[model samples]
Target: MNTVTRPRILVVGAGFAGVECVRRLERKLSPDEADVTLVTPFAYQLYLPLLPQVASGVLTPQSIAVSLRRSKKYRTRIIPGGAIGVDLKSKVCVIRTITDQIVDEPYDYIVLAPGSITRTFDIPGLTDHAFGMKTLAEAAYIRDHVIAQLDLADASQDPVERASRLQFVVVGGGYAGTETAACLQRLTHAAVKRYPRLDPSLIKWHLIDIAPKLMPELGEKLGSSAQEILRRRGIEISLGTSIAKAGPEEVTFTDGRVIPTRTLIWTAGVVASPLIATLGAETVKGRLAVAPEMNLPGEDGVFALGDSAAVPDLAKGDGAMCPPTAQHALRQGRHVADNVIASLRAQTMKPYVHKDLGLVVDLGGTDAVSKPLGIELRGLPAQAVARGYHWSALRTNVAKTRVMTNWLLNAVAGDDFVRTGFQARKAARLKDFEYTDAYLTPEQVRARVEGARAPE
Candidate 1:
């Protein structure tokens, strides 16, 4: 009797980890040996680090998102869907396709890299009044919304409404929040020139965070310099503070200060996708707990990486977990791929380790800050390095070229300031993106009511 080995690997979420894993696995395993399938909600990989640039018109949205098929030359199949649930015991994953159809697929091995979703706070009116910057859709919506607001402010006859429309508030001093404020401020400054009726001074930019310092991870010197640049550009920086309440017209701060603003961008933080909770596995800080090799303990043939996995940072000397950033995710993806191939061949797997390689921040235009190696840099040189680094880091040549072209055009001319007009009306609900069971279909509701009335 002859034994045939069946090997099919399912990779959830085509972000940094899943994409790298599939690309490497394709190289390591021959076409006859195994099949690789990559699952994601979208067809492209979003370069999140430079998303603020996209929102501020520094780069078009297409520049940051590289299509999966365009980048990979291997035979990996791309499955367009979001994994809703995973039964670790059965090695089956329940996925919800874009059209809302549900399907369960089984795999010989699985790599969980579902990534994360925006972490919302319980502050009053936040869900109704705040905008999140987690997805490409959200970023695009913000870009349109900001430009639209400028238009509205210039056109409005009422002074109060005009003031509200012009004022922008962002909560979170972390990299995402700070970069967003910087980028949007630059956008409005350039855009207001087109609207002579509106003063750039009327367009207020406020950045608030509960932390004592901005970009604390960037160290004191660089963070302070970044904050100073933003302040000089008329951006109001409020540290050790947060919003207590947010209304349609204004936001009240915890410190009893109130600001009239229609825009409240939230980049406070992110947590692992809800799919992790459905896996029935131990998780640390909402992430699936995994060994340094990115394998789930006690779960055979199952692995996890990227933001969804709590990978220990051995390079830190201490046992702290790796921070969720593109820097770590890129490296983790490669390590996980090698480990997976090693596992398939019954070989020893190496541990994942990486040190902080400094940070780069583009403050839109010629203002930027960075600390490549151990030396701190700022101003035009920093801006050059920052943009250059992002350009080089792009996964595909198409994305790289598109981004470069956008920059060149912007430099020669200026922002078109043309709104895509997607979010003329607000999308205030999470269910708008991912429908929940609480929202039953008409058929489901009727069936449920009928089943209730029919004797048990």
Candidate 2:
């Protein structure tokens, strides 16, 4: 007598979409229904919206990293690796494990939610000198680097060295760039009190974007409101401007101005993960193009979502694709899980549909702007809504407790302005955080699946 093998369902990320999809799958599917496997380098689902808080020392790194193994309901075999490539025709995924081991994983159903990487231009010294705010390691390292700058500036006898260390430049005016500059600026503002030798007046932060307006999606009124708040806090806002070149000690702007600074934090934007290119599939603006049901056209049992996929926005009807936001990714995750279940049961799959739920910008402290459900709010009210929404979105009780405790502790006692000193010897650049060149070529992927050893 022959026993039937359970169908394998592979999820290729631990981000908001992938984690939510895995959780929903585990909760709804029986133990014998299918074998679930999650492929990711880390075991935690990073709450990216609150990353600036982590970098600012308002929250610990573990507070935002919701562990995948914490759930008792989890039956998915977790693979501590990243899926570098996927072959749709052969239904195989090539993975590079954390220990430098290569493996091939075959699956009956595949969910491509590999997310995105920080987008960078060909500007000189960008890949070498710029720090990113995308990963947990980067955030932690940035905190140390920021604190180190303060320490160095305080001890420096040369006015030029001190001035260069005191100034900081942040690129991009979108939510990530704005919030990162705001939170880190607040960090320096509070930390300056601890350094007796450093002059608080010397500290400066410049926020620049190529776009004419800052966070244009927030509407003119709220956008201006946000600008006013930042300007009031002494953050220099330069719109319709971007970096022409980046140097180790300074950055040149497109508007023919050069600013001397030791730190350049790039939160400009993101493009889909490089893994999407291995499939040789159609893409819209660097994101994989998927059907409204979140499945790749003409490929059964293959699905995609999150930042890697250009999922059509059914609600917005004019050939529009959903924006790469956590809100849409979270919803799309659950919807895609339901569709996966339907596919297994031979039922019809429904299209993913969600309306714009408005935007929130946490500028650290009581300065926040939010338009939840079309209601525009600013100051204390907006701050409350923003924090509440983020706090409630956490997945587990353990995570929620840790985050709340951290928030309370921060509110009551404040930060110590100390650096961990781990990043002093580490490489903390855009290329270091995002391994954009790690994915295998399409031909190599096919060879790997066919039992041939491909070139390293």
lDDT of each: 0.84, 0.93
Which candidate tops lDDT? Answer: 2
- CA RMSD (A), model 2: 1.8
Candidate 1 displacement at residue 151 in angstroms: 1.3
Clashes per model (N, Cα, C within 3 A): 0, 0
Clashing pairs in 1: none
lDDT of 2 by residue, 1-456 (tens): 999999899999999999999989998999999999999999999999999999999999999999888867678999999999898988889999999898889899999999999999999899899999899999998888888999999899999999999999999999999999999999999999988888899999999999999999999999999999999999999999999989889999999998999999999999999999999999999899999999999998999999999999989999999999999999999999999999988999999999988899999888999999989999999999998999999988988999899988988898768798866876678788888878999988887787644555
For candidate 2, report its TM-score.
0.98
* Candidate 1 regions with alpha-carbon error over 4 angstroms: 1-5, 425-456
Q: Lowest-scoring 10 consecutive residues by lDDT in candidate 1?
A: 433-442
